[model samples]
Target: MTDSGAVLPWLVIREDDNGNRYRVGRYATRTEAEQVADRLGARAHERLYVVERVDRATA
Candidate 1:
């Protein structure tokens, strides 16, 4: 997890019973989802999200 109003990016990772990995979403800014990942730690699969600034129309 990152500090509030952090400009850093974040990733949301989730695993299923079969041990499949998935990325729920990518955020340009740190959010609650990132915090969840931090708390879950190694128990959860890794999903990386990079911080990128894009035009709203293109994004």
Candidate 2:
């Protein structure tokens, strides 16, 4: 759960050295790449959004 009181969807965002970007969505697992995708979808561009999950960190 996130601070917003909603189930926090783990997401990712990536930026190429050239400044190109893309978004992949609704993954059952989370990763840095997935979070990058979500961030890109949310902020860098106006497009259809999707939800994904991040891997639970293991201690």
Winning model by TM-score: 1
- Report backbone clashes per prediction: 0, 13
State, as a TM-score between 0 and 1, how close model 1 is to the true structure.
Answer: 0.36
- Residue 26 Cα positional deviation in candidate 2, in Å, after optimal superposition: 11
- For model 1, residues 1-59, the per-residue Cα lDDT tens digits are 23665443455656665667666655665656566656665454454322233345543
lDDT of each: 0.52, 0.47
Give the TM-scores of the predictions, in the order they appear.
Answer: 0.36, 0.26
lDDT of 2 by residue, 7-56 (tens): 44554434455665444433334564456555665765435344445444
Name the weakest run of 10 consecutive residues (lDDT summed) in model 2.
Answer: 50-59
Question: Cα-based RMSD of the predictions, in order?
Answer: 7.7, 8.2
| Candidate 1 wrong stretches, greater than 4 Å | 1-8, 35-59
